[model samples]
Target chain A: MKSTWMMRAFALASLFMAGSAWAEVVVKIGFAGPLSGPIAHLGKDEEYGARLALEDANAAGLTLGGEKVRFELVAEDDQADPRTATTVAQRLVDLGVRGVVGHVTSGAAIPASRIYDQAGIPHVTPSATSPKLTQQGYRTSFRVIANDLQQGTAMARYAADTLKLRKVAIIDDRTAYGQGLADAFAEAGRKLGIEVVGREFTNDKATDFMAILTRVKARQPEALFYGGMDPQGGPLLRQMRQLGMNTQFLGGDGACTAEMLKLAGPALKEGAYCTQSGLPKTKMPGGEAFFARFKKRFNMDVQLYAPYSYDATNALIQAIKTAGSADPARYLPALQTIRFNGITGPIAFDERGDVREGGVTLFRFENGAWVAVP
Target chain B: MDILLQQIVNGLVVGSVYALIALGYTMVYGILGLINFAHGEVLMIGALTALQTLGVLERIAPDLGPLAQLAIALGVAVPVCMTLGFLMERLAYRRLRNAPRLAPLITAIGVSFLLQTVAMILWGRNYHTFPQLIPTTPLEPVSGVFITPVQITIVVVSALMMAGLLVLVNRTRLGRAMRATAENHRVASLMGVDVNAIIGATFVIGAGLAAVAGVMFASNYGIAHYAMGFLPGLKAFTAAVLGGIGNLGGAMLGGIVLGLVESLGAGYIEHLSFGFLNSSYQDIFAFIILGLVLIFRPTGLLGERVSDRA
Candidate 1:
């Protein structure tokens, strides 16, 4: 009787070990952005988007190498500073993340891209729009949003052709993203025969723009183009109005946010326009369902770039599934040529790791909400 | 010419706030002989406190007039900041009073960071749109020169507060005691004056000024955040030094001059640099002036002889 009981115990232990061997594998993916600064809201938005995607993927019971896999997101705060971004990237690499989903600002993304490339970890930026981010020729660097060159060109053309403006002034906040977009806009504006009236620059942290506006007022431009985030853009518009400068205001994706409406208040009621780097939500393939599901899960409205971040995360998962491996080296090749119908639109990368079908959308402030302009 | 006039108006409006903050730095340095680096953080706390108070008032008493709401917010912020100022000196600076001069300065910086971190925890890292209690609609005092009612209030309130501070310092018994304590701590104590109490009073008074400056700043800019006080604080410190670190009149003078220079510099920097540079160089003017002053006339514009300090 004792020998039979011992034999049964040994048999049960082996069966349990076999069951454990077939359990799900956990894969870590890194997300880095300014999680604790002025732009923390935007970073948190991107993070939630990635989290939703991972949760969905887990619910779908993904399998890799014939074993169930679970995706874990490791988020880091880069503070939107370039020096900190490189350190965060190394930390993620050290933590054994197979892929990364951010380094949100272009200033942060460009520097961090070098570290990811060196470590052989493929990273995709959901929002960083500076052309230099992808132009560095890093195989590991990919961006889902349209670059500054494309968005800037679209805004300049809209101003010149649609608005029928002959003269425009430009101002930038002297940040990597802001200055790059302004430069692209200026180049495009000159090519379209629009007379550039004034060019001014301010730091990102400054709130006062009375002096700049005073000078711009003297130039008497028909419209003004601002290349900066909404924090500065909103105040600039308010100050412009206070100075009695009734000029049309235009901005790139940075200034085209719901937060801008609150910041600019009554000032935005007249002649404000912006361009976003993707198609409007109504125009996207799976936008409605994604938004509804997101609201249900997060209990908050999607700010901006959340959809792109969701698509980026899904692309990484798809690439991992296609390669049938969790290793970075194995899935990188799959990621290079991965194609899918994302919520934002078709998701495919060209040789430079830029989305093949990047679209720009124009928006105007109507009834205190951003309305897409056809 | 009209642009120049408008820039001047902008400069004066901004300058008055700087002067208000500068008074805090000057008075503290006057009595303690320590540069309170955390003075700026005090301004931030003041603004945030007012913002919090306003939020509560809006919920509890929504029918209050804007001016009354503002007055109540200022009342709460002033006392809170005063208490903070008193605690800072008693808890942190008092222990390091006899240590090397650098000790108190470093401790002040540490205090500043601590306050900022605590604020970040309380308020989170988002910029709050400070409600403009004062109307922001511009009134053209002169043709092509626009000034808002908020701007006028900032200037008028600052001048009145400065005048009140002057009378308190020059015409009150407390002021005499403060002057004695600043002259010699031990001698002031020997003369039966409560040296500690006088020093504490000085801090409280200065903090009150900073609270007002904080509200004015947020009202003018229409936004407030955890890090908002840092730049203005540094600029105010420069203003104090430009006028002479411990001199009251000098701080006011330095603030207006610095503000005018900055505004005019930003307005015409492109032309001044012959198009090679632009208004982004606006921050360079303050530091450049500080450097020039330190090298040429360290006594500052209104500063007396160094021998008269003690």
Candidate 2:
């Protein structure tokens, strides 16, 4: 019986090899993220991440059912819009991709994930942090970034315990991402015994923030948290200085840009705090090497989420390697077991696709640049 | 009292810009009875011209004084706007001289899009920050609220320009010709009033006013981009319509009203239980107001019936 089983295994192995030679067995991976628009820097970094990881895996060869295979990356540009995200997701499905590592913005990821779920494709989002993403309870869905709930609490802890602030005002751009972060910060501040003095709303396109700042000024808040991108935040900082309400500013990663100095003008003085997912570049394990190569390749400061994108891509590619198949059905469970060290930090994801050891960085706007706060 | 005072100062600063652009819209509409949709794009070009001129000046004389920089910006802006205004009339609207009313308006839109595309290619989509033209530090903070010198400069300069425009339109002999041309182009041409020259003059003034507003906008904001004119243009159009589309005084009034409404809207919105109408919807508020005025008061607050001769 044992000899018969050994003969059967040998026969199966030869058959697989013959099939591989004839079929040129390949598993395609789909990566959808923002690749263009005002917030495009992060998306480009993400695409590069997928490319690096897949390239490495393809170099070593994918072992599926103990047969050699190749990996293909199918990248789609969502332009950071939700409607575009759904169309891209559907296109990837029609192409019969195995899995996906994508979705930069929560607004886009939430709607796009539904398409992936229906198609039975597991997708891991490296950056979408809105809590409602996991609340949907889709089996094929997962998020790798620290959610708003965690980030909001952490920011609040920093403000209350670290900064020792008393009263604070918060404003949101009224979009999904901006409002989500705002609500989280507000809730955390209240929980941490900080007086939530005032809250205001503005559009993402606005340049004049005098009215909002003036209103917040009346309340005399010690700090103002602006939940928006650098485009709006920069001008707000400048106007705040010009308006003579020289209060401290707290913001999320959206405000983490060198351009903010130009936007806010001379008022981008020292002590403005910004929080972002993952360790600072100088803190990441393989950050310096990635930065060196990226700077050499891109000829610019890897300006946004290049590090996170790099790691997210490597993690997805590794899962394909261990599973040795392109079938997401075969590799997704294996993907959940990812325990790899990434450029951003240690890469691990829960069954829901959220990162297990999600990290964040804190920095301050000082002397015309974002100086990482120790 | 202090909050209200601070809000008023904020309103006046932005209102000055709204009024300047509105004056341009009103002047063109008053003379030609044609809404120049491309006025905003012309404004953007004027701004880019100013930016380029300042850049050259900065390169040539890095330590140039503020007066010299302002002079160079104006020098570049004036001629560019004049040439742009001349070409727009000759190329785009001239063909539609005898077409239906909608024809010239559609041409204006095409011209607007064309200019926007050109701007995107020339300037790229990213916002470019210009060097600070005005001192930005606030003068003082009284009762924890204050206004900047730039705000005062904006209000004062806009007021002076408006006052000069009023004198030019009402008191000058050239103003009489313009009024005659606007009243009846065919009759005025037959009467030897030089209707075409008056029309060209109107373009030059409107284009020039738009340039001034563009310069002020870039100076205060520290940046300019291709789409910078869009929101400001919409608000200024609203200002023109609200004050009475063809009435010069009405445009100024409309601008101040819109600015106040925008500033007060945020305050009132925050006071609302749910903030259903926050600052995010400020532009929408202006549009809504425009729609309501068109629906109920088509002639607007100070508009005169065309049948009633001035």
Number of backbone collisions per candidate, in order? 0, 9
Which lDDT value does model 2 have at A374? Answer: 84
Question: In order, what are the TM-scores of chain A for the candidates?
Answer: 0.94, 0.88
Candidate 1 lDDT by residue in tens digits, B1-310 = 8999999999998889889999999988887888999999999999999999999999999999999999999999999999999999999998887888899999999999998888899998878888999988898658679999999999999999989988888899999998888788899999999988998898889988998999999987888889888989998999998988888998899899888888998998888889877788987876788789878888888876344553
Q: Report model 2's TM-score to 2 decimal places.
A: 0.87
Report every candidate's CA lDDT: 0.90, 0.80
| Residue A49, model 2: Cα distance from true site in angstroms | 4.9
Least accurate stretch of 10 residues (summed lDDT) in model 1 chain B? B301-310
* Stretches > 4 Å off in candidate 2: A1-37, A41-79, A83-101, A120-123, A327-331, B97-107, B141-145, B171-177, B193-200, B270-292, B305-310
Supply DockQ values for each candidate: 0.67, 0.39
True contacts kept of each: 0.75, 0.59
- What TM value does chain B of candidate 1 have? 0.97
How does candidate 1 score on lDDT? 0.90
Q: How well is each residue in A129-177 modelled by candidate 2, as lDDT tens digits?
A: 7887877888777766677777777788899999999899998887667
